[model samples]
Target: MAYHADIIVDENGKTKCGLCKVFIKDSDIYIEDHLKDTEHSDMYLQRLMIQNNIVINGKKISCLLCNQVSDVAEVLHHIDSSSHKGKMSSVKKIIEKDGGLLVLPEDITTVGSKVNCLVCDGWVEFNQEAVKTHIESAKHRRARAIVVQPLNAIFSVEGSSEDLWCKICQVYFENYIEVIFEHVDEDPIHLKNIGKLNLLIKDQNIDIEKYLHDPKEDKALCKRCGIEVPCNIDNLDRHIRGKQHLKNKK
Candidate 1:
């Protein structure tokens, strides 16, 4: 077995970092500083690859939770976790078989691993590229747009503060917001006002229309485009199935 550098310390010590924080170390820093930030530790899982001589090089794997790998994570319908024994082990096996790692980002608080994303629910990996496609994907907008109520209440119309949870691909994140929403700001997104609570989406099916409504009726605005598209589901339907929307549908 290759001893990865991250394994130098078990997951116990790894909890030192928070999912939102970033940590970079100079070679001069002590081992104590390794967990100082959550950046690399989250999306880029660093492990020590040890050789026979006990020397180890730091190896990196794209976060399996980030959804870069082609894996499908499904929530078992109506099975209570209380009755399951070591359930995570089974989930890990399924993900491994798909060449990806399936995991619950919500589990990070206790397990000591930081999730790369919270908004995307773990679909878009922690990179600029995957994020670009995910948000741009119609699926992301539809799921997240419903979240706009919680989002708008907590964030600006521009949606500066939001955490997207995508159960479909199972990645949680910030960048996915930019990918799904149009015209990200020239600034980073923030969720400073949001409490340490998460809202779970219950729909197993992807229904964009159910949540979509005429903004005019509610006097609302689009998080993207910043223009007031018709707030009604009918108008939004036209917008969604329109030329640009259809292109993204593909």
Candidate 2:
């Protein structure tokens, strides 16, 4: 029996229902009858429920998307506002590009401040920036790539040696240097040995000329610690920071 004022708009000397997009005659009876029609009423209610993310309870209308509560009379203006539309757009994008990474709640209509992550198996804040941070995290990347992508995809092969050796995993592929590709791709142990010999060459702290022993095998010798360190960020960092190595360096 009641309708929002904005639902009726005057366009070029014609009165039309903005929600239903139907022209109304210039009489109170005609406008009232059109607003009371079953089709128009159903469409208006459905739009508020779905598109506007509103929950109707008695006289109170709650906007789940924007976390706002408004009177039924003000529902149209609240939903039509720019702020509510922007929130809807952000939520839509998060759902569209989820890629099986997020575990949307069963009651999507009542989604709260957080959502579960399928990859990391943990709760993440329900927002674009929070979801992005979780997806880009190392823990999430490792979990997602456990079966599909190789963890060492960032590692690069060095030189064109006939005998290929993985300095990270310490595995030699002998004359079958090309087989190293398959080894890197399928080897589960490669995840634990997060090293790329090629990356160590660029480090100023690692005196490549002095500390490096076997370039062909990608081995680095810590003269202070008297130990062979794998040519990777993890191993080199640990060796460099060791108490004995620091003591001997001085």
lDDT of 1 by residue, 67-105 (tens): 222211211111212322233344444333322322333
Name the TM-score of candidate 2. 0.30
lDDT of 1 at 72: 17
TM-score, per-candidate, Cα-based: 0.22, 0.30
Off by over 4 Å in 2: 1-40, 95-250
Per-model lDDT: 0.33, 0.60
The clash numbers for all candidates, in the given order, read 35, 0
Off by over 4 Å in 1: 1-120, 154-250
Best model per lDDT: 2
Candidate 2 C-alpha lDDT tens digits along 37-118: 9988886666546545576778988887677888988887887889988976675566445345576443324344356776
